[model samples]
Target: MNDKHFDKIKNNDGFIAALDQSGGSTPKALAAYGVPETAYSNDDEMFKLVHDMRTRIITSPAFSSEKILGAILFEQTMDREIEGKYTGDYLADKGVVPFLKVDKGLAEKENGVQMMKPIHDLDETLRRANERHIFGTKMRSVIHEPNEEGIKAVVDQQFDIAKRIIEAGLVPIIEPEVDINSSDKEKCEDMLKEEILKHLNELSSDQLVMLKLTIPTKANLYKELIEHPNVVRVVALSGGYSRDEANEKLKENDGLIASFSRALASDLHADQSDAEFNQSLQKAVDSIHDASVNKK
Candidate 1:
């Protein structure tokens, strides 16, 4: 990324929002939001529905405000048009940096954990990010517990891809999401921190990275990460927490900001009245924004 583009997003104090749902999840997410199952019975129909839903979010009142500094989009939605302009361009016009989800999805488990599957066409993906004017990218891998081998596997994969993304001149949000209800949550977090620091230590000062971890079980578990010189910012994922619960968890951390998906869009439903949808979305935005800004 160029200095001006990088600084534009890096300096943001507002939270990030994840709106990227892959093809497999598109039908389910629409169904959960009360879109009739019949409306998205096939891939073609489903893509349109997902694109429409993304449109709703981009055009939502909350999206125009400073509370949302950026959004991560699915490939299908990132380039679609909004009011005669591409989606990413539209977000930039509204002062929200656009990002893309570049991972293919999780791979089959190995060593009792599942790591993010590599993007086979990463060069093309990064080129697309640049062409679309996207500012960053995010990929997810899941850690079940504090297994040393498993953590190493996940971190190495994430860092490998992150190096590629940084080389492509876009930020990478490395997400090794620990299951929120894991019994060894605290230990798992410590393992992640150590591994992340080890990888970061090898990078020169010019290379930077971003993190999107699950809400730590213990308060300030990510403090060192937030303060690390090579880390641009640290944000937390809601995983499965409700809005109120996620907000509370975020409040306990000193520097982590929200980069929520489900928690950020928790109460919005397709069946709701327009006023109700707006009310719920604004509330979610305010709660997350408040938690992020209060840390500063």
Candidate 2:
């Protein structure tokens, strides 16, 4: 991304609604919407369900304005349009930036940690993102505990892809999600933070990176990260928290904002009334927004 595009993202500082659910995530969300598993016996059927959900989100009034600065879209939803216009164009028209998820999902454990599968054809993906007028990209890899070796592996691989993403002209949101259920949460956060600093300390003066981390047990645990020269913003994922629980925890952090998917769309389902769905979405957005900007 150019300086102007990067500035656009940095200047907003608003919550990002992560709607980038892949194949594995799509079924779970659809099941919650009352769609039976037997219905998705085929890929086409599953695609339709995902498409409908994304269309609902893009067209929702709650997502149309400035309250959401950006959204991370799945590959399938990347090409879909709203009102005969491209999805990215649709978002831009409504004053919301659009980002694409480029990772090929997670691979099996390596060194006791799950790593993000390498992008199969990242150059082409970046080309597609550029064609779609996307502003940035997000990729996820999980850190299960405070294993130093595992944390180092995750951090190294994340930044390795980040460099290519930056070279391709898209800002990268590096997500090394710490398992929220881990008992050693505090130690995990510290090691992860240190590993992050190791990468940031090596960045060129012109480089800027964003982080999407699990909210640490201690509020303001990422203060140094938020203030880092090469780090533009720090956002939090809900991980497995409920809507209310996520908002409560998010409020405790001074600088982190929400980039949540489940928390943002918690109670809304395909079966709900449009009014009901919108109400839930609005509630999620309002609570998250209020908590993120309301410093302790």
Model 2 stretches astray by more than 4 angstroms: 2-5
- Model 1 residue 37 CA deviation (Å) reads 2.6
Q: Candidate 1, 228: how far from true, in Å?
A: 1.1
Give one digit per residue, the lDDT tens place, for model 2 in 1-296.
64555665676657888989887888888777667778778977897787788788778888755678788998878888778988888888887788898889898976657898878799999999999999899999988878999999999999999999888888899999998988888898999999999899999987778999999998889999988998878899999998778888988888788999988877777888999888877888888888777766
TM-score of each model, in listed order = 0.96, 0.96
List lDDT for all candidates, in order: 0.85, 0.85
**On residues 169-245, what C-alpha lDDT tens digit does candidate 1 reach at each position?**
98999999998877888899899899999998998998899999998888998898898888988888989898788
Give, for candidate 1, the lowest lDDT window spanning 10 residues: 1-10
Clashes of each: 1, 1
